[model samples]
Target: MKRSFVALMAFTLLIAIIGFSAHLVVLEINDTHGHAWPYGNYGGFAAIATIVNQVRSEAQANGWDFLFLHAGDVNTGVPESDMLYARPDILALDMMGLNAMTIGNHEFDHPWSVLSRQMAWADFPFLSANIVYKGTDKTVGQPYLIENFPDLKVAILGLTTKTTEYIGNPEYVKGYDFLSPDEVAQKYVPMLQKMVGPDGIVIALTHLGIFGYSEQTVAGTPGAVETAEKLDPPNNPYGGSVSLAQSVSGIAAIFDGHSHTAVTSPFNVNGTLIVQAGSYSKYIARLDLIVENGHVATYTYKLITVSKDIKPNEAIQDLLTAYQIVGSGKLNEPIGYSKVNFANEKDSTRKADTLIGHLITDAVAWKFKDMGVQAVLMNGGGIRAPIPAGTITYKTVLTVLPFGNTVVILKIKGSDLLKAIQWGGVYHPEDTGARLNEWGLTYTVTPNGVENILLDGKPIDPDAIYTVATNDYMANGGDNYSMLKNAQQYNTGYVLADVVKEYIEHISPIESYPFTPRWTEVK
Candidate 1:
């Protein structure tokens, strides 16, 4: 009887220790794309900070520890952040106590020299195991970091998308090689596990776009499912070509960005959990992980929208207000004024027609008309927002074209242009570029219908090689238009934002027109 009682007592002790184990609370926000302020009632860093603080306090009260992380892409959106070279956003994040972050493609939007300087201001460690230094195999940041808890050690690692080679400025990424995520995991996981002594938990922060696949080609056209797939580690001894949650072993939770889609519930893939907060500070994702007796027992995730109703923390609001006040003073200076009004109206949450798309594409085409350019195909996916009605400023120009893309003229056969257009259209039909910027190009976009693209009332001859003016993004085959890379590029030496700014200033106030379907419906 005493033997049985002692055994039962031991079991009870185990349960009590497990219940008292320290729990972890992970908060994630990604794809700010430089949206540091509230745009159209949706996002702002101050509001996000408020929500995070509230949740952190509540979670702490519940015996949980908090770690704030940003998946990547902290640069290039609103005028305030981009105008100062994303300084305000980085400073703001530092004030909020960002724990760790993954290096996103946009981080190299500026010159590498500039990025190197900016890294000094970051409060958290920039993590990317796949990005190797130029001419060396060294990783960009420390591969992994282990945080000690009362009952467990948590190791965090980072991975950047291989697509960064094509998306980022090749000049900045020179001499550097971005290894495959799957390969990196296979090598590093074992090393980290050994170092953690087999009792630690692993987490991966990834910026490899989202899971949803868009089947379209570049040049704003549509066709078969002939497009580049989203980056995922391949199926192997490490894992499958699925989400980071599925591929990397030992990753208990994943924070993802790049595609900008938010997954609130834990996307279960082979028993791993994935969570992503929507982009631009619109949502803060919280993951409550319960570790019992040296193992993860449960993971609860929630997506908290930073709506206006939530009272902004006073301290955060004051900091934001001070920054904006200074930013407004500098940004409000009139470089040029608009004589018309432009608006990007939407039905529900899907993209629709926009006058800004038309004007910007027109400006780009016009800038290179003297160079024998036949047509220009500007990807609608690149257009971030519409120029607001009323006065336009230098800041407005930056917001409209935040990516710092340069203009390049590509020499391509007319046939390839048509093929490219068809691909982009079929995949992202709602996009303005796929819809042919309706205002400038003459084309008919119908599902499975004869793909026809006309320039200046004439069908392009298939055999003719034409000079095409486009941003460097398309020149590098971004948005699944790989064929353009072979096309000889003639640099126009024109800053994309400058050209658009000149056009907007000359066009005066943007005139709002009735919203109409940009693509024709054919039977």
Candidate 2:
């Protein structure tokens, strides 16, 4: 009887220990894309810092653990940040006390020299477990970071999308191998679990995206949901955060980027909570978790909009202001004016021909008209933003074309061009970045393939060679357009933004341009 009573007392003690709760607050931002300054009264490093600081202070006062994380893509998108090699953005993040960040695909947009320099400038480590030097096990950056709290330890692992190999600049990422995230996670997660012990939590910080197979039908890249569910072939051709969650067993939650999704409520997949804040620093995701007996017992999530109501942090604002002033002087100079808005919204540009698409392609066609370039093709994804009707500045032009890609003229047989057009229109009616925007050509998108192919109003002759102008990205097989890779090529060495700027200046009062349907879909 005495021994039984002792066992009961011990079990009661265990239950008490398990019931003890610890509070943890995590703030995450993904795909900032160098919008350090607020636009349209939403998002800015200064404003983001203010909210982060407040949360950090509150957590400190309450004896709760706090973490501030960025999911990646800190480079590109803004002229002020891009011209300075994202110095201001990195400095501002450092000042904001960012704990860690993932290495996004866009990080590979420039040469290794630029990325290496940017890495050296940041205070926090850039994490990616699957990105390894070619033919070696060596990683480009820290794979995961371990943070210790009074009650438990947290393991944060970083995984980038395998699509980086193709979507990222091929020239720059040639030295690295983007391994499948699921394979890497399966290998490392168990090790992380053992290191953290049973009670500790393992979290995935990824740039793998959250869209499911249906959303990315053509690309066959699975999102967090598809990955988590482990959808079969054609749906989840490439693994994602979701796959990691299902394939591996130790992860408590996942913070992801890449799809630019605004996950208002956390997605609970295979007992793992997944969250992603929309891109461009427009939203900050706050996750408050209650940990008990080494597991997440309860949680709440909110995607905080970086509205103007939130006052900007003075210190961060001052730092960004200096850089902004330097670039603003040249970028803000009025270059031209537009009578009507040239819409470049992602869905509009990718699904159908738009005015902005026509304007950009027309500019390219105009620049190389003397070179006998018959038509120009620009990837819909390349048109980053819209040009609202008003004064157009160099900044506006740069914002639209931020990749610094030069123009390339290719000589290809009409048959090859048809393949390229068909590939571009394969995902018609559905938004895809690979869709081609054309000038000086028109075609019909049929269920089977492209038809009515015409160049300058004449039916294209399959055996004839045609001169086509496109960006260096496409000429080198970017966006999976491999048809043009082997074609005869001439690199013009002119920055696309500068070309567009010159065109805008020459056509100043930019009243209108050809808006004819470049491609029509026939169901």
Predicted model with the maximum TM-score: 2
Which window of ten consecutive residues has the lowest lDDT sum in model 2?
213-222
- Model 1 alpha-carbon drift over 4 Å, by segment: 1-20, 55-63, 213-242, 309-315, 334-354, 410-441, 444-450, 462-465, 509-523
CA lDDT of each prediction against the hidden true structure:
0.68, 0.84
- Candidate 1, after superposition: displacement of residue 54 in Å? 4.0
Poorest lDDT segment (10 consecutive residues) of candidate 1: 216-225
Residue 293 Cα positional deviation in candidate 2, in Å, after optimal superposition: 3.3
Root-mean-square deviation of every model: 6.3, 4.2
State each candidate's clash count.
25, 4
- lDDT by residue for model 2 over 170-276, one digit each (tens)? 77888999988888887888889888776678888998876453222121123544553644222243555666666677788899888787877777777788788
Quality of model 1 by C-alpha lDDT = 0.68
Candidate 2 structure, TM-score to reference: 0.92
